[model samples]
Each structure stands twice: as structure tokens, then as C-alpha cells.
Target chain A: MANISQPSQGAWTRMLPNSAAAFHRISALLTLAILVIAFSFASPAFLSVNNTLTILLQTSVIGLLGIGMTMVIITGGIDLSVGSVLALSGTVTGMMVKAGVPVVPAMMLGVCMGAACGLFNGFVVTKMKITPFVATLGMMLIARGAALQLTGAAPISQLGEAFGVLGNGALFRVVEMGDNGFPRVIFPGIPYPAILLVVVAIVASYMLRRRAIGRHIYATGSNEEAARLSGVLVDRTKLIAYTLSGALAGVAGNVLMSRLITAQPSEGVMYELDAIAAAVIGGASLMGGVGGISGTMIGAFIIGVLRNGLNMGGVSSFIQQIVIGFVVIGAVYIDQLRNRR
Target chain B: MSQTLQAAARFDAETTPLVEMRGIEKHFGGVVAVDGVSLDLRPGEVVGVLGHNGAGKSCLMRILSGAMAPSRGEIRIAGDVVEMGSPQDARAHGVETIYQTLALADHLDAPSNLFLGRELKTRFGNLDDKRMLAEARKVLATLNPNFTNLKDPVSSLSGGQRQVIAIARAIYFDVKILIMDEPTAALGPSETAMVADLIRKLRAQGIGIFLVSHDMHDVFDLCDRVVVMNKGKLVGAHDIDEVHKDDILSLIIKGELPTDWRPRNLGELEAAR
Candidate 1:
């Protein structure tokens, strides 16, 4: 036991390059770079500016949800109802807009509704003493049912052009030379949804790395008993994490609705899985207390690139799903190996 | 014979105790873990609690530390009765506990662990990592001068280093009374000596210490008074200079005072010295 308690000299040398967390993040970035290079070589369209924008736009919704998922996972908890909550939030906004409500108010109400759902989950998990997995699982069913009930199981379409700008509009358009030396319209208009993703990622990363609440979150996840003994309000921290996740899900729902110009009660079905996968691939551990936003963003990009490249290369969506499933498992396996060392 | 000695250790107006736990009782289901055990600790004093595995020493201390609530007890800190509903409550009243497990977040670095729940923040309300790191370095330097790797997570640290960090945390927040449960249980000889010196330093600063341990030598070396418990009941309380090691051993094992002994007064103790 004494020998085990003392770290070996060799282990110190191995850890010198970086801490274990840094190592995981570096490996994640390396994997993403390799994928980008490989995909660019495999498909001519993969490296195009339009295709790059498409990937970022595609990743925006899931990326926002992944940021929230990263926070939840760091506290050693899971929010399985994010997709359902997103669907319900978007459906509510669509229904309100159809009933002649202004777009901005409708979107704000939708976000609030999403936060309310999260607060409910927090109450169930913290106040009622239910496990996070079970509480969020129940919320998943409830939110999905609520979405269907609100929309009468139909899709709400024909939202105004103003609402669509939140998802489809781009800014800072510029022209540049293409790979073939032809003058191409390189309008690098940044999508609003992608902008939202970047802003959320920056805020979340700053909170996790430079804020007291963020430190408390990590401490709470790492060891609840210890945090409690150290005078931390563990319940409040968890409640905030769940609430943030719910609100982000709402934002994702709005982005999806605007991008498609329609809101369906089933629009975000199975999206929670993708969000969780992105966070995990970015190095967020299911066991909690070990993840960050940057890693999660990279993880989100990795998934986005894989899906876009595979589709362009004529790979079936079924095969893409299999590959994604294996990637999630592989990432967690590597995490376990790192922990064991 | 030790009963009179126990009675003499009771609080008086002239020397108010730093902490006084009166009639602490804890029950789990039908089993009584602690049965009306009362203890007192004075400033700049070390009170060693000695007991068998199931003798209720931990339960009594846990109640004082606010980790567990006593079924019935009144805790007075500095002559004022206070409620200990949670560890936060205890800390608010200048009470801190160093648990046997150390209660450290293994994923966090030394500075983070030192300010785990109550972190110092900058003017902008962000965590002031630079300030915390500097403070942690000062604290760690005083405890263990050889410890310099403040960036590694505690999981990567040795048992001794971890113990030092735990101790530093307890003392950093202006602790008036510290409850240490088996602090040196996992340390080597040099590490143990280091802790012993730290304890003496704290004692010099007028902080009260409640040390729960099974090591007889530690009790003899560091304690001013020794309290023995067995089967959920306190058997004896003796001034270190007034009782023999065999007397404490007999009380711990049999839950009874020594047969051929008489409680001696302070003057008698001085004469014996």
C-alpha cells in the first residue's frame, strides 16, 4: 500500500509533457487534425470553403448542446432530456409565433421554458433525492410528450423571414481565390448559429477555468462528501448546471427551427445522444470531474467533419452511425486507460 | 479512581474551554454509537481521544465537526452555545475538521484543494488563481518545505503530501478548534515527526486540538490530557503527567478505572513532576 501510495519516478517523467487532462486534450486535437487531413484527401469537396461553412453550420446546434452537456458531465451527472426539451421549446416558440406573437418574445419565452424544464430536473434530482440519470430520463419522456401535445403531432412551418435570419443569415462576406486559381466568391459570412456556438463555448470555458462556481462544480463532481465538508453548497451547484444545460438546449432548438424554417415536435429526436457523444469525444468523462469546453468543441467538430465527409464520399448514413458509436466507446476506453495509469 | 480526575477536568468560569461538547448521544437504528459522551478542549491544549474500534470516539467527534448530528447534545464554542447543522455551520464558528479520509478532491490541484469550496475571488468575481497559489505556497512551505509541485492533482501526490495539504486547509481559514481524525495514521516516521512539529506550532498559536487516534505513543508524546472510551461510553479522563500508560491501557480495554489509584490534584501533579 505504501509503495502504491508513492508515485514512481518513471510515472513523473511520463507526466512531464503535461497533466493527464492536457494529454487527453492534445490527443483529441491530434485525432481531429488527422481526420481533417484524411477527409480533405478523400473528397475534393471536403476542403472547400462552402463545405467548411456547412460543417460549422451543421455542428452549431449540437455544439451548443454539447457545451451544456460538458458542464453536466463534469458534475458527475447526465442530462438525457436535452433533445426533448429542445423540441418542446422550439414547438412552444413556433406555436406562439403562429398565434401572432413577436419573434423575439417568442424565442425568449421558449428559452425560459427550456430553463424551467431544467429547473424541474434539478428539483427532482436535488430536492427529491432522485438520481440524475433517472430524473432526466423521466424529463425526456415528459418534454417530448409536451412537445407533441402542443403541436398536435404536426410540424409548424412558414415562420417569417426575420426569424430565419437567426439561423441562416451570414456576415462579413468576402471574395478570394479558389484552389484552381479562379476568382471565387469567398463570402466568409459567419452564420448566426455558429456565432452563438462560439459565444457559448467562450463563456462556458471561462466559467469552468476562471470562476469560483466552476471550481465548485469540479469539486462537487470529484467528491461530493469532500465538497460538503469544505463548506460547498453541492445542491445549488448541481441545480445551476442542470438549468444551464436546459437553457442551452432551448437555444439549440431555436437555431434548428430557424435554419429549417420549420419546427417539428420530433425535430431534435436523438440529438441528446449526439451532444453527449461530442462531449465525451472531447474528453468529458462520464464518471465526472474531468472535462472542458475546448475539448468538447473539438469533439463536436470531429463529429461534424466525419458526418459531412462521409456523406460527400458516398458512405451510407448507417455506416456513419456505426462509426460514431465506435468512436464514443473508443474515447471512453482511452479515458479509462489514462485513469488507470 | 479516575472518576475524580474526570470530574476535575470539568469547565470552570476562570478557564473557559474553546469547545465543549456536552452529553453527546448518537444512535443508528437500535444500536447506540455514542451514549452521552461529554468532552472539553481548551485553547492551546491538545486532548487525545483513545478508544477501541467501536468505542464511539469517531461518532462523538463527527457530531462536533457537524458531519453528523447528535441525537441529543449541546455544543458550546467559546462559552456560547451554537448549532452545528452542517460542516459550513461549523466553519462559520471557526471550527474545522480534518477527516481520516482527508476529504480532498483528487482531480484538483493543491491550490484548488486548499480553497475547495470557499475560493478567493478577484474584483471581477473571477477565481483569483494567482493569489490562491501564492497563499497555498506560503501555507505548504510552513508545513512541508520540500513540497513544491503545487500544480499536480492530489491523486498524483504521496500519502504524506496529501496529509500535509489536508492539514494546511484546516489551518488556513483561521481555525480556532481543529478536529483531526487519525492524522498520522498513514504517514512514515519523518512525516509523522513533521506533523508532530506542526501540531506543537498550532498549539503555540492558541488553537485547540482534538486528536482521535489509536496510537499510544502519539497520545503520550503530544497530548496534554487523554480521554479513553469503550463500548460507546467514556471510561476515563486523565492529565498526562498524573496517569501511567498502563492505566490508560487498562481503562481502554476493560472500560473501567484502574483499581489501585487515587485522583491527584494539580499540586500533586507538580510535586510528582
Candidate 2:
């Protein structure tokens, strides 16, 4: 646990403590232990390799959104519009692809649509002095309306096989060693999108830990007036944060559409709460100035695993919600304890 | 007074002064802060400004540093009159002010704070961090050797180290006239001694200094001349060698030398001491 402290506090050596961060690492390990133990007792299916893959796949979409939310929260802002933006962007991409646009252009247009929405939110928050919630809430309605209007409140289906490959494809054939007659190979099957999520998480971790701009973002979040007095471009920093969050949300929505082979206007209706909760559970503070991508990834995994394990144990969907809600509350209370110390 | 004489005698270089402010006046809202105050600062000289509360010492220095616009005044730097519209204007005209807080960001280290608002950039438009770190080390070596540990964040530094960083920043920016407000206000004896040494080092570099402080001991120890202000008006200017601590106290409180103020008899004062 103490060894892992080096990575956590090395990024902000002065602001945090090595021993204090070690405690957080210990807490994370303890939670993982509890998950493994509980899941092992819940159902035999929860311990299977196939079930683990399902958990990873389920986490990928929310994990992507959580990464961007981490960055936004670190810079002292929130994007309530991300869920609606995701639906809108996915709907637009699905419509464009149905209209004979190439897969590449559709994806590009979808990403641009998300970035444009974020830009509008950024402008309102920075230029007009609107608070983050109010500004992104306004964007939430606008994007929701646009999504419904474009889809006529119906799901757009028949996204081509090539487009669906991003979410549903396995890069290589799965091989087994037993008498199932699946030829054994050096490697097993891996989802391309899952690999992509891992790559994105690694890149985000590197950028946040090793870059000067990353330091500036933390500084702005810690004390905006101090950061500005030190000549950091506060407005520009916030704009970039919000824009990146929107783009990530767009990517998540696209991944979902690619998986389902359709865009539902009702998709991602309340996913923002789940994404925010995942990030907070992972150690991000709503008050800002803390948390990272790696923590958020673990947080997403926790939620995904909980859902999968609960379902396998015959828990009802409503009960699952209640359980997750309690988990969110508990995670936040622990985070507060760590912070106060 | 004798100590001040010895300090001033060491730095007296040329007859002509470096900075001259004539009839400086400033008004804030409906109130007049500085009324017709004139001052002259010579090269390699330490000039102290003393005043009671609301006596316009800060207002006058702010005008000098271009932090504020003087309602009326004429400032001459190196015998040429100059106009100041902003703090940047003061920097362009070789004037720098070091406030009490030092204005160094706690999260940043010495090198970063040394170039805070004006960071050095590489050809690719990124921060020239390597060059900045090297230059910071060089400046610390030349100015304050104790500050060679520049890698530590400013928040971890002591009061003396923070003060040194502020002074080093002014020196790096090529400030000809340094305006320091209460440089050692909260320092202990040793820390204050270190700052006094830094002021002497700056004086040796041929920079003019306008020191605003209420400490007569520091003024008597470092300043060559002292200017006193009372009730938003200039009280009087005195060569530190020609005046005692009582004279400054009297000037600050009453806006004039105390009546019946005379040097104590040496035998009796020595017995008391």
C-alpha cells in the first residue's frame, strides 16, 4: 500500500502526503477484497471468467464518461449535460450513418456535435458568469430536445456491421485448450473497445501526472483566484476541461450505439448520475481539486461488478439501485473522512 | 544614527540622484491621500519612508510602482520624466515593487515564481522550464546563497527564503529602482539580519531602493535617508546620520521634530545602557 503511494503523491508532492495516500491505497485494496469475497459467496457464476469479461464490458462505457468527469471535477466544474449530449450525439451519428454517410464521417460529426455543445456550455459559464450546474443543465435540455426531435422519439436502427464492430467486435478468435475442439492459441479473445478503454485510461493518467498543464488544472481547481493571480488562463482551462468531457461523453454514446446497432433517444437519460457517482466513488471530490483517471476506472469497475454480482445472486433491479445508492453514500463518507484527516 | 552614517558612507557614489518625484499628489474618491510630496532617490542608496496610519505612504508608493494613477505628479527616472499608466508601465520603466505578501504562489517553486506572470517560453511555445530552472539557480547563487535550494515549493520555505525569492525576482527582471514595503515586518533577528544583508547586496549592485517600513531600528540600520509622512502630507526628510530614533518617532506622531528634543548626555545614557 505504501509503495503505491509514490504514484499518488508524486504528481503533487507538496500538496499531499505520501503516508496519507498510502492509506487510500489500503482502502482501495480492502474494498477489492470485500468485492471478491462477497461475489464468491453470492453465486458460482460470479467467479467465472466469462462473468468477469461481462463486468469489464459493462464498465467500458461509463468508465469512458467517468474519465472526462474526473478531469472536469479536478478543474472545479461539473457537466450535467453529458448524458443528454451522449444521446444526442449517438442519435445524430446513427441518423447520419442511416443516411449513407461513411462510418468515419459519422463518428467525426458525432464528436463535433458533442464538442460544440460543450463549447456553448463553456461560453455561458465563463463569459456570462453562470454557474457550472445551471449552464450545463441548460445544455442538458437543449441536447435532449435535439435528440428527440431528430429521432422523432423513436430508436434509429440498422447501423452497419462495420460501424458496430467498435463496440461488438472481438479483435481475434477465442481459443480453448480443452476438448471443445476450439484450437488452443497463445492468447485468448480480446474486445478491441475494451483495449481502447485501457489505452485511453493510460494516456489520461500520463497526461494528468506528468504534464505542466495538468498542474495548472489542479491549481485552478484548488483556488481559482490564486491561479488567475499567478497568471493561469482560468477561462481557457475551464473551457478545455468541459469540451473534453463532452467529447468523451460522445465517445461513450457512440460505443453504446455501436454495441446496440441502434440509437435510442431515451438512451443515457440518467446516466450522468451514474457516471458522476462512479467518479465520486473512485475518490473524486465534487468540491474539486482531487481525483484522477485511474481511480475513476476502478470506480466504474466497482459499480459494474456490483450490478453483475447482484443480478447473478437473484437481486431485483430495484434492489440493485438501492444497493448502488447506498454504496455511493458510503464511498463519499469515506472520502470525507480521508479528506478531513 | 552613527550606524546609519557608516552604512550611507559606504554606498555614496555620484552626486546626482537616480529617481526624482516632484510635487506628487493623489486623491481617492473625495479624499486626498498624498498631497504634494517630493522625494529624491540616489543610485546605490536606501531611502526609508515612514508614516502613521492613513498617512498615504502606500498611496505614494503605489503611484511610484504604477499600481495606481497619481492625481498629479511628475516622475523622473535617470533625469528623464516618465509616465506610468499601469504596473506593466512601471516594469517597462525599470520600477518594481515587492509587497509584504511577496506574491509568490505557494504551490510553485522558486524558479516558477521567479517568472510567474511572465514565464519563459521555448521556441515551441511551451514553458522553457529547463532554462528557467537554470537561471533561477544562477540568480539565487548571485543574490542569496541560502536560497540555492530552489526545488522546494514556496509554501515550504521560511519567511526569509520567501523574501529572498521576491528580491531575486526584482533583480532578474532588471529593476533599476526596487520599492519594498515592510520587507522584514514579521521576521526574527536572524531573518531580519539576512534581509538587511540582501539590501546591502542590492545597494552594491547600483540599484535605488525606496523602503517603506515602520521599524526605526531597521531604518537606522539600512537606510541612508528617511522620509516621514503625517496626515497625507510630507513631514520632513532627514539624513539618517543626522537624526536619532526619537526624531523619527516624533516626526511620525506629531508631523514635526519634538520640542526640547536633544541628544542625551553620554555619561548618563551609558550608565542606563
Candidate 3:
């Protein structure tokens, strides 16, 4: 009824903050683009190809986690243990590789461990009848403590170069040979981690768009009781969401570990906040039933670019935090105003 | 308990009923929500349930729709007893309900809401959104020619449009018994009339309907038979023409027929009809 009158007449209405969900993502994308342009203007180095790739490389971890968080939030649920679960999965994978397990299998096992943690989160949230916030908050502490206890509070080091390929390797590598000097590299096509992010984002976006499970998630989040009466498997939909969130966190953990070649129990301490912030900025409502991978990917870029830009601008890390915090708040405020309209 | 009402029965009750609720009893903790009540709905019949607030009309309907499980009861669809553990089971048995709240996802488009649990999928097991859109347009057009904007979320629709979506959702699938709870409660007069027309159309299509309503006039205009409930007990069911509105009112308020009420003879009932 609200937009029943000549729906296609106003292009301006489509651009407003109170536009459709797709346009909500566009707003986030536009914001990301603006941030990139502004940062390039603020610092010339920010426009360099090397610096651009670095921003995307850093965004891979949070962007992957954002894919899962978007799904969980869309089910009107939250997972606070992704950061800690990432540490746990990374450490477990580290232990496995150190014990002579194949790097790929260890990595797969790591993702499984993350999925297990997520399953626990889902179980507690659904079966134990605990609120998702409290349930996942409890898992957060438990997973972090478990990670520390597993290694006697020591970091797993020297994970070997073979395991590092997933997060540190590059694809389509280009090398130039010249007579002036020895072989010189001309370009690195794409970081393996960034490629991984792209692939995962594509699959996730497809699932949310073209899957029954995806429809159930939106329905459950919009109104759980209505969904139940409509015969939606609400509980199962939520379980799948939290479990997938965990698996993606596991992937991020492996990427982090591969980049560092060390699994630190203290690593990913506040990464959950980053993932949540990215989702919110990407137009995902905290109340759920409204978000997508595209917006979330842009949200991750916004955060990464904002940090790189601020650091380039010679702002302190503390002030960068303050600025990023306000941006998140501003994004939500605009969303609120849109909903009010 | 009346010969005239039996003579005026619109449906052939002797045949196997489409739905048979046997000794349906529901208890919420220490409270008795629905007492031992049994009812039957045959194919193509519209059975209207009349009751006051908390008089157990909703509870009975909820149990029938599989939204709530009766503490003690047996339900049969087409003469086969069923254990309706959830709404999905009820739907599997060709039972669909349009709840009082409409129960539509506010954020999903019409097609998405139309196939909330049971979705159309391609051979690859992915959602067949294109086919769903086409099917939704066809189904909604049959109900309301004015309905457009299948892409917009249900939240943006008008009251009548929302009602149409709810009805379309219920009737789209292989629904045999359509349960409508206060279908016209939120509609304007014209919308209410539209719903009435829809009910009639569905009845003509041989879809047995369970119409739960507070509007007596609507019930009389649409329902073939009416059952009055008071304090979780069924007072009686009467053919629409056999009993006056005041007699049904007495059953609702007092849980009994009026002292001076008498069943009209078959000849008089036939003459009146």
C-alpha cells in the first residue's frame, strides 16, 4: 500500500534511503566507493595498486566472516563466538599440521572444528532455549579459553610454507625477464586469499538468492511465529545459519594463520566486532531478515579502506577506531530513518 | 436434535466427511480450553464456528489446523486418523489455514510468501524463482485483477491486497479444507464483500471451508451450517435456514436453546425453504 501508486514513476524514490532492500545495498556500495575516492584524494599512495590489493587482502578475513554473519543476522540470530572459534580452529589445524597431517586435510579439519563450534552455538540458541546473544557470548569465552588451554597459552609457529598457500599465495603470477637485470616480476594477478573471498562470496550470494533454505531464513527472521504456522522449519533454518557462520569463521582463521604462519590464541580477539560492523554497514539489520553478501563485501572494503586511509592520513589507531565506530553508527542511523519513512 | 434442521442439511453428512474431529479435548495446564467436542466437515461445505472471546473457537481451529495439538483427540482426514504433530503434517494432509494475523512474512515478496515452506525448485534443487513468479501472477489474478506489484514485500500491500495474498496462499496448493480465521476482521466493507465472494467461489470449487468468525451476518450469508460454542463446549449445529439468528445467539450466550424454542416440523422447514 505504501508504494502502490505508480511504483516505477520515481527514480528518485528508488535512490532514497527508504528504498527497497536492493537499493539499501546500493547505498552501502556507494558509501564504499565514496570512501575509496575520498581516501585516494587524501593520500596519493592510497590509489596505488599495491595499496589497493593490500586493502582487499586485509578485507578477506572479515568479508568471509561477514558472509556468515549476514545469514545468522537474517535469521534474527547472532554468533559472538566466531572470533574465538577462528582461533580455536586455527590452533587445532596448526597442531594437526605440526603432527605431520597433510596441510589440506588439516585445513579442512580446521573448518570442521569451526563448524562444530557453530553447531554448538546453534544448539544452545535453539534447543537450550537460550537467547542467541547470551548463548554465543558464552561460547565466545569457552572457545577462547579452549584455544589457550590447548596450547598452554603459547602460539603455534612454523606452520611451514605449504600450508601458507591458501592465504599467502598468488594466482596468475607474472614474471618479466630482462637483460638489464635478472628476472623481474611485472605483476601478481590476484592474491589467493582474495580469490577465495570472491569464490565464497559468489556461492553465498547464490545460496541466499536461489535456495529454499534462504527463503526460510528470511521468513523466520521476519516473524518466527508466523513462519512456524506457515510450516517453515524455523529451528533447522537457524541451525544451518549458525553452523555456516562457524564454517566461514574457520576459513577466515585458516587465512589468518596462513598469512602469519602462526596460530596465536590471542589472534582474532575483536574480529567478531569487525564482522558485525561490516554486516551492519552492509545494510544488515541487527534485528535480522535484511542483508546480503554483496553489501557485506562492500562493508568489509569500507572498513579496510577506512583504516588504510586513516593510517595514511597519519591518524592514530585509536582515532581510527573512533572514526570507524561513528561510521557504523551513522550507517544504522540512516537505516533507521529509512525504515521510519 | 431437530428433524427440520436435518431435513434442511445442505451437505450429505452420510458420506465420508472430508474432516472428522473425534472427541477433541485440549487442556492448558489446569485450564480447560476445549472440552470433549467432535465435529465433521464434508466436502464443499462451509462450517462456521461461532463463539465469544476465549470461548474456544480459536483453540479448536488451531488444533484442527495443526498449529496446536489437542491434549486428547483424534483427527481423521478422508476417514484416515492422523497424528498432526505440526502444521507441516496438517498441510501434508491438504489442510491449509489463513490465520487471523494473515501470518505473512513482511519482508518477502508475494511469491516468496506464497511458497514459504513448500517452495518450487529446479532440477538442480535450487529455488525456481521464475516459475514461482509466473505461478503467483496467475493465482493472484484469479482472486484480484487489481493486484499488481508481485515484486514488493507483503508489508507494502493494502489490507485487501494482503487478504488476497493470504487467501491465495491457502488455496494455491492442493488444499481440501481451507481454514479462514476472522478473514474479514481487518478489511473495509468492500474488502469484506470481496472476501465473502471469494469464500463462495472456493465453496463452489468443492473446497471444504472452516470459517471462524464473529460477524453473524457474514456467517449467515456464507455458511451452510453454523456451530455455536460456549465455554469450550459445543451447544449445537443448525442448518442456516432451520434456526433463527436469535436461537444461535441463545446457544452462544447461554450454552442452551431458548426455553420457548421448538424445532420446526419437516413440512414447515420445506415450505420456508
**Candidate topping lDDT:** 1
What lDDT is obtained when candidate 3 is compared to the true structure?
0.89
| lDDT score for candidate 1 against the true structure | 0.89
Q: List ranges where model 1 is wrong by over 4 Å.
A: A1-16, A173-188, B1-13, B262-273
Off by over 4 Å in 2: A1-22, A175-188, A338-341, B1-182, B207-216, B224-273
Q: In candidate 3, what are the lDDT values of residues A1-341, reduced to their tens digit?
A: 65865565355455564446766688788888898899898888999877877887999999999999999999998889999999999999999999999999999999999999999999998899999999999999999999999999999998899988887788887889889989876876689889999999999998898988988999999989889998998889999999999999999999999899998888999899999999999889888778888888988998999998998999999999999999999889878756754
Worst 10 residues of 3 chain B by lDDT: B1-10
lDDT of 1 by residue, A1-341 (tens): 76885667457557635587777788888888999999999988899888999999999999999999999999999999999999999998898898899999999999999999999999999999999999999999999999999889999999888778788888776768888999777586888888889999999999999998899889988998998889889999999999999999999999899888898899888999999999999998888889999999988998999899999999999999999999898888878767776
* Candidate closest to the true structure, highest DockQ: 3
Give one digit per residue, the lDDT tens place, for model 1 in B1-273.
435435434335478889888888899999999988788888988989998988999888888888898899899999999999999889998998999999999999999999988899999999999999999999999988999999999989999999999999999997999999999998999989988998899999999999998888998899988898899988888777677778888889998767886554557756768
Clashes of each: 0, 0, 2
**Which regions of candidate 3 deviate over 4 angstroms?**
A1-19, A176-184, B1-10, B264-273
lDDT of 2 by residue, B191-236 (tens): 6787789789889998899999988888999998888889888886
- Residue pairs that clash (backbone atoms under 3 angstroms), model 1: none
Would you estimate the TM-scores of all the predictions? Answer: 0.94, 0.73, 0.94
* Candidate 3 CAPRI-style tier: medium
Flag the better candidate by TM-score, 2 or 3: 3
CAPRI band for model 1: medium
